[model samples]
Target chain A: MKSLIGWGVKPVDSHVNEKNDKAWTFKQKLFLGLTPGQYLGQALRNPFNWILGIIFAVGLPLIAYRYFFGLGAVTHASNDYPWGLFLGFGLFVMVPLSASGFMLGTTVEIFGRHDFEPIERLALLNGLLGYFFAVVYLLIDLGQPWRLPYPMFVSFGPAAVLFLVAWHVATYLSVQVAEVSVSFFEWIGWLGGKRFIRRIAIGLTVSGIILSTLHQGALGALFNYAPGKVHPLWYSPFQWIHFFCSSIPAGLCMVIVVSTIVKKTMAWRCDSNFSDNLDRCTLGLAKGASLALITYLVIKLIGIAHDNEWGYLATGWGAWFLLEMAVGVVLPIILFAYAIRHQVVKVARLGAMITVLGIALNRLNTALIAFNWQLYQEIPHIFEVIIAVTIFAIYIVVYRFILYRLPILYSWKAQPEEALAAEAVRPAPIRTTPSPAGAMYRKID
Target chain B: MSGISRRRFLAASVAGCAATTLAGPRKALASGTFSGYPDGMGVLVDLTRCVGCRSCEAACNKEQKLPAPDRPFDDMSVFDETFHDGKQKRRPDENAYTVVNRYNPEGGAPVYRKVQCNHCNEPACLSSCFVNAYTKTEEGAVVYNSKVCVGCRTCMVACPFHVPAYSYSSSLDPVIKKCIFCYDTRLKNGLPPACVDICPQEALTFGKRKDLIKIGHQRIETHPGRYVARLYGEKELGGTSWMYLAPVAFDQVGFDPTPGNEPIINNVKDFLGTVPMVLAIWPAMFTGFHLLAKKQKGHDDHEHDAEQQQGEDGGEQ
Candidate 1:
């Protein structure tokens, strides 16, 4: 009668029995079978939480102070450099990285790449958390956060590229919520809800593709509003294409990176199916990422050529630009290719980490560093950096909380006997009709 | 549900049509060449007569009723002000709508350039505002409505001249601060802005924009040695309501000599054009991919069954 629920997947009956398990409730499920004091102790003992504690100590007050005392209190508040790090990192960088939901949704659902099914839920969850947190970052940065709905309800500047970005991002957030909700429904044992979602799943995914395509490109086109202000090297008529194409690899590699982190740090949460096939999934994602990286590099070069910005390459900015390409784009391409050929997942993981860094660097450079190339660089204020890091920490906490509980990296257990029945009724070798995803919802004996 | 009531359906269709027609004209201006409204007012700034006096800045401050400056307007020492960026002289900010910066050319005398909103014909701030908070008035003023503004600061970034500043010190209510060409009080009443009216040396000329352009060229042609032949704002960013003629080259006096003739919005049209294409094509394209995958799965299932039968027969033999 000891708890079967520890740090791994918890089925419906894992904490519930006909006699005594009925006493265990949502509170027990939330606490992961540990007492409240034990949970607090476990959290405090982790060194990472201590670092987060220190960040929130300084940063939470700063955020409150920013609202009370105004943006000028914590920021240098230069009108010339209006965007700063809040947008450069949070909106611009995070949006592209969160493209994972649509990417994996397409791979597994649309393309019928069922090998990718194990990681699809994880990708969807990562995408949802990233976008939700990006909005949180935006609220901190906006001067009038309460009026965030102005673009949608009060007034419409349909001509503006930012107007497109605003509307699409809002709609896409809902799409991501619905897509990730399937896992949430499964975890909560709502078979009916999961089935309803599965029925409209194709409609949701197609809209996701449309929304992701427009908004990811729209973020780049926002810079087109500042023609001479952005450096010639970074600004192009094809800036939209550059952002959209690079996001493909960024999205794919982000999935690999998140899965790798989950496997290394919290293997107990992963079922054997996930742990066993993770290496193969990593290589498959790396193949997609390498193809995207190569396409991104060529399009970037084409952008430079179309603009005839070859002369800027001789300057210091051009050298920095080349270094970003070499490290972020070229090196990842070579390493991913090498890893795929040699079947070295460790090397592919390293490539993914570098790619994430590279994408972050590219967004920062375009938004802050290379902006106003003639003027001096705008170094983000100390408080601004702290708030950014704090928001990112909150993102990680929410991400981990969900991954630990949801049927993302592992399958959820149905009723005790039904779960066993499902195992017994696994699809025969020659039987293939409805997708595994659809078949997963079949009634078991 | 009974299909929408007939009255409701008719009302909805009428409202939809009305909205489309109302939005139609605005969409037309988002692309193509936009020379300003024909009767738009303009200012001609003759830099030779400015004489480094800060009267325009003082006049602007008084008219706008902005917060008092750290240094008094009469303080001549303000001419030597330096910004946090090591070399930048004061540009316009929240407190003052206009500023006069003294740019001293190497061997010549000091030239004072008064900086404020240029009131662009095709204003980037107006185009980039997602909330439609900015309006390019027929009076040739780029005006803002702070009530609808979400203050995302895209306007500040989009301004080529860096004219708009935000009231970042106001926690409860922060808004963009920029010169509106005194549209509500002065320009609409057929009177010049306070700064133009108070110019001691007739340095700032107020007239029709077309007339000012002709006047600007006449002065340059008449006194070629005293002026650079180029008029600063006539063709910059698709022309502006304010034009300047300076003795020194425009860059020496802090004007972007080559800001290009195309307006900022033109640079974004190509990307915007592709948006509808993507919306139209992606659904069909991806749905086709899904169908193809389903078809391939069917083919694979057939092969698997055939192979199983062949293996069963071989085992029996």
Candidate 2:
């Protein structure tokens, strides 16, 4: 067999191979390593970067304009539709999709499903970045972002559902950071740090599960505050359950979608184990997602029935709701189930895409479209859309940077394993590379 | 089955049946009840008596220390004001704390309804605020503090009455602007709010919530055919600190008739009750499945090891 890297392939001295690359150091990795020149090079290489550049050029000044002028400048500033895409998409949708961290953590660590070990770190990383960016989106939306910690150490709203969400999301972000830090520990050659995390891995996974379940559900419950405001088809007293249940599939399918994207775009970064088992794992994950989607579809109907909202099914909003259900929920479920059973990997990938769109649509419906059902619709400002896109671009850039360096995609080269073994077994320390996969494999167990 | 075990099963079944029967009716009973504190204060504003004098709007603006409006307080031309969409009425904004909207019902002169915070007995804004920015005082006023507010605007989403307006222009120190029911100026001192006190036609009545309900009923009874059969806010959404007596139906003036008698918080309680259950149950259930799977994997590994050893022995022989 021909070597995968052909003889004609140039040994490019990319940033990945640079000596004293800042990303290799503990301090630099913490900052997301790149020399200022290399960072700018990567930014200029991608066409998406040009789009982001255009967006920030227009949006950053507009954001500053908003602060200098007012929200009225960038937004419609209607009393009827107070919350636009910022809260709608940024907070509601982003939070639930980011639930991937806890769901995958619970499966791999708490449930001891070592077969899922390959993508576990990716899921954790996806979650941490998603949440960190969600907060960033929030800072832009908040009238007073500086006071974000007020709900915690400051005045506490113990009785509010939002209060619960605020506390849990803050705590859960910390939990996810701890969960993903194992990879960072290995990259920095902190063996002691890695071992300590391994010992408490189960506890962290369990806590992640608990926190994810509550806050994801809590986001939906936030809508329950506006019983009359949200359309009947979308509103249910059991909305929390609907949000929580749908998030399972959303989170699961998000991993499949992200991994698929990574496989296509950054194949060099992925290790052999991850690339080899990906097809089987994708099928397995799609099966789980399909089951969750079916449950979600049934419960969604049950919620409508429980609220006795059959009359709403005849309306225009009802048609839109049905379309969302048919396309986002039912279609994806059918495709995923069919694709998984038939071993059609491409079809399963398509289904995962549909599921991602479905989650976004459901969130958009709840937050923006269905909200203020009686009021005129408020389209987000052009600048607002640009800013949202720009932020997402930044998210992808950060995601790519981490994947290129972290042991998350590629297993770390163990440092002088023979020396450690000989030091324990004999007086002489013979140096050799340790089994790179052993730490992660054992920690996953 | 053993006799002891059979008897225990029978006893458990009987106890379960009895417990279900006892609990079933109690759950239904809890869902139907609605009552506010007997002494909670309330306001009753009669639309028929309101002259559209703009006195209440002026009083509210002055008392709240809100910024000056573009038009003078005495400008009746403001009543004929239209929005950019040509909607013939302007609502209260960040600058104006309160505005009276004129709705011309069929066969009736324009009926003016003052729009401000209803200060519900169970304020949705108070419950929805993540930082506890709002306070629903026992005096039947819903007040807020700007200091600790993250300005998430969740309260704006939660308010059923669509009352809270954000100071979006004030980038440095934006806060929610809404009616506080004069908690600091009057309600705490046992006086009526500025709007109520300054009503020249006595259109606004201030009293205990229970007494306000009675007074509203008395006016309807005396006139018999003058007012609608319903007293707006007497029972809507668990009742509001401010009530209304209009000759026309409440919905004709944009009041949501179907808010139900129960407070908005009651709708949220069902979900809140499940939070603790999910937190407690999911960890153990997932961990149990993990252990079972691990045990199965161990068994499979052990059997495979034994089979390999047998193959090795045959090769040696």
Candidate 3:
């Protein structure tokens, strides 16, 4: 792919071909301005695609097997442990990690921090895809995955915490689709939809904040029903706050982790605006994450103190809990502090990676490990693990597919007429900016 | 920014209103101390009188028309069948709605405990279900509507007694399987459940839940040292329909010792109460933040770039 780019291949970041000033057709756009052979060549050349192939070879069948033979075929399906890895990992773990959308939206839009604007669209796309795949994992895990709309249409259990989860996730998915579709509008040259979304951007952002808060906290509240089941060490009276607060860091750190990966792997796809601003944005996010991490750490201790389960700290489970905090919470806090102070983006990136893992660990502990602590631990079935990995692989594939084509990493350059319209409008679009980069792309005009 | 915030605030307020209307009435009905119904029936199982005969298990199997057991109802070897590496005893599942597990606490004789849904006054399954699949009936039988069940198995996660098992083996339509206290067949007609009816040793007593409370206390008061003084479900998780009297400690017979008196729903009410609060406060509050931010942006321009300021004002939010 890098060799192809060396041979003067241009990935589609706008509608026009710089060569003859001819409009790139939808086919050309889909292929990143490559011929079908070249598209296939680039895909096959990448070893990552081969790994995805190997996973899908085994995983797709297992997913079908689960559906055909029922969840019992691939899962332990034990009465003692109802929610296996599918939910423990898929729903509980994925949702918090995907919270980058609301966090960045609130920052760049509400707080008017346009310096973070370069990565805002990426954050939104991350949130959208993460949530979409979380639901995909859910559909695979559910007994009647097809009846997902039962809560909304057929029946209503509005009082249940899960009811809020279903409604908010569904509503928030639509909200995210609208939020991220601005990029698609630019990619497809649909100025009207872009303008319409721009008109209601504030409304959309405000709603995003509301839905994100309730659903993120509601996910934690679901565990409150099983007070006797989840271990006292992980369980808390203020489980919602613990979940909500921790997600602030979880979401921010996830953005850090994702942006770092994007920067390293796909630097060509990024504009100077993105690459130059990323480190600063990352450090800024790290600062926010450290603050949230401290709050989460303190509240976690407060939960323990309120419960008077400080005695559990000496026990093995307590050690495990402390390990989570030390690695996931406290270590990151210290690292972020030092990195921000020293302006070392690398250390902050490492902290972000660990924080991502820490959030995963914390959620996995609350939902799986520390759950049923009285009973013996139940390892997930091999097939269940395979299916989960498969879905996540698909998630990555879809994420890359968008990042390669859409203007998430690079600001899309509007045509002259569109630019005139953009100038007439105020503040321009979120990521789109007037720059020398756009001047370099104009062919004859 | 003000126009956008005002419109969004109105939209958010409507959403808040919708949340309230949707969650309010149902919660009001469920709120406060909801003890069982006035004429609710209950069962009192006296462990001191039980002989681990397995007759009640047989009666339950026959009554519910469950699949044929691997061992017949007469098999005593099933008592020793522990599962999940002996950490768990035989439990109610898709095949059987009730099971009797034999627990031999250290230095005590083997005590048999009938394991089934405790049918709490405020059932966790009832509260945890997003489909409203469970119901604590007027007769105190915590029944289920499998037709409405989406098979999320949240009920299984929420059931503290581990009674509501999923029919995971069925690919087409799996649902929660649990003892409904024979609500459909016998209890609706004012007849006792088959297990309670077929208790040859009279270990299971069936009557009004209120009367049964008195009877349970009387037995504990009258027969000194014969039974554990505490009634296992008189106030456990907001009073189960099936109360227990054990010869040994309740925990010795596989009961949770610290199943608090407050209903399981109480634990979640704190979070649930905040849903409306968050929905109401966040839009206006965050919009105010946005206005403040835009104000700062405007001051930076200082009337030099009026067009840019207007753009910032609209696009900032």
Candidate 4:
């Protein structure tokens, strides 16, 4: 891989490649010029990989068992609780966190906030992988995974909320793939692909925003089907609004959370532009999150009042609801506000973590814990938990693999002119000298 | 900068505003009402006359060709079954289309509520179904097409009565199992449902929904103290094909008394109303925000240019 980046090689323009030249075949792109040993070394060095290996070892068998024996093999399989952690964590929680792609695409491409350009690819990739993995989770949880597309083509359940979810998520996944493909173009030295996407970027971003708004809200609309099953505090007819509103903060904070983890765990993969601008980006994200959180908090209160569910607040479930609001929404709001004002990036990071937890809690409350409120609570079967974790680990591995290889955290080295232009745009600091080492560092950045 | 440009902008804005106002609320209003087909059929089950004999259960089992139960049809021991930490008494499932639950209320003879699909006049399962697998027949029973079912179980979620059950144990194909009011065997042919026909005690009444309501009222009026005043399904959850008359309170017999008079679909209308609005409005709104942000960026560029020029002058000084 290092030798492949040698100075004599001219970068391929994706637009030109698409028209005149053959693009890198899928096999060539997948290998990425790495020797098998380097790949294995990197894979084995991470402790996270060992954990993932253990999970896959345990969970793959259970997943097979579930298919062969039945859903009763790995799940509690109560007719009362048809959906469990699989749908709750996988579909509900994952989809909102994955909203990062459209949000960032709209910011940079449509809104032209180029300051956000550094993390834009990362967010798009996050969204694509999150959605892709969410579908994967659905496949595992579905009784008939093979018939997944039946709702789209075989049968038409146009009136059903799940029908909307199926169509939108499928469409949105394709949009996200197109959005994220620009990074793949750069990584494989294809500039024509990049330029063509850039030309249609505004249209794609706008469409992305529209699709994401409906589907994110649609996921919430799903819970409205079970008004009696979900606890009152979580169930609102305006659930779609609550879901859409909360997702704004959830998506922004997820970027903060993921970026924070990336910075800590894989700093070498990030360029200085990304590493240095991260704190400023964290503050910017915190400001956005605080505004969203306050709106969410107010509307949540309104939902309670609108339904006259204030009396339910005195009960244990209400206390649990309050706890979720306090820890997840309210506490994070205050923390983000204070953190942004004081320029406390660490506190903002902590607030982002809390907000992520809050989003998970809210989804779980709706989908599982408070589901069938009149019935006994169900803990996920051990095998079921392992399968969920294993799938998530696969998501993380794919996320890291893309981040490591793609131009997400670093500018693509396209033409020498664009490289020089990027250098000129950067605030000149201590490294203007033309020593051989300095030139190499400059090229690397 | 010119009057003509301003006039053109104003004209465009007016057109856009006109288009939005015309399209927005009209679409919302269209999705709100879900009045069932006027001539759709419905059934009325009178529970007060039920004697807990399990005759209807046997009849339904035979009519549906379901697998035999572990115990004999005459076994009373099945009624004592409890599940989910004793929070639930056994109701209907995939094999058992209808089950009689014994709810012992205070100061009342234990009520035997024969539970099955109420087959709503405006069925939530019908509206919530994306593939349109469910249909409300003019004969009044809600029937489903198993061929089209993907078994996503949205019908299970949409059913306010918790009537739809999936055969999760099946590996290859699973369909939502519920009482179709014996649509294929009897209801469609102008025959009373098998369970209704076989009931020795005349506990189960099968008639036009309107006529059944009148008969229930007449029965209540004839014997005031023998039954509760209100018909259980007359207006609950926007009315059901199977009506109930109980000597004890409805809640005592495992019925949810407070599922509002509005149909289950009504609860979802507010969200569905927003879908088209979002599809129409979000594009322009986000695009407008983009244009505003772009304009701000342009202003920032001009300020940076001014600052750059000032810095050069200071360097020369």
Candidate with maximal lDDT: 3
Instruction: List ranges where model 4 is wrong by over 4 Å.
Output: A1-34, A415-445, B1-41, B299-317
TM-score of chain B of 4: 0.83
Q: Residue A92 in model 4: shift from native, Å?
A: 0.7
lDDT (tens digit, per residue) of candidate 1 on A124-163: 8878887898899889888999999998789999888888
Give the Å shift of residue A57 in candidate 3: 0.5
Proportion of true inter-chain contacts also present in candidate 3: 0.67
- DockQ for all candidate structures vs. native: 0.37, 0.30, 0.54, 0.34
Which residue window of length 10 is worst by lDDT in model 3 chain B?
Answer: B300-309
Query: What's every prediction's RMSD, in angstroms?
Result: 7.2, 8.2, 3.5, 7.3
User: Model 1: per-residue lDDT, tens digit, B89-108?
Assistant: 78888999999988899799
For model 2 chain A, give the 10-residue run with minimal summed lDDT.
Answer: A8-17
Error of 1 at B213 (Å): 1.1
Candidate 3 C-alpha error for residue A178, in Å: 0.8
| Candidate 1 CAPRI level | acceptable
lDDT of 4 by residue, A199-318 (tens): 345556766776788779888988887888888999998998889888888888889999999998877557677787788878987898899899999999999999999999999999
Report how far residue B75 has shifted in candidate 3, in Å: 1.0
Best by DockQ: 3
Question: Model 3 off-target regions past 4 Å?
Answer: A418-434, A438-445, B2-5, B8-21, B24-29, B299-317
Better of 1 and 4 by TM-score: 1
lDDT of 1: 0.81
Candidate 2 residue-wise lDDT, B1-317, digit = tens: 12332343234323322311232232233344345566778889898888888999999989989878898888888777766455336766788878988888989888988888888887888877777788777778889998888888888888888889888777788888888888998899998899998989999999998899889999999997789888889888888888999989888876887788878888877866666566547656755665565566765334323433343343346
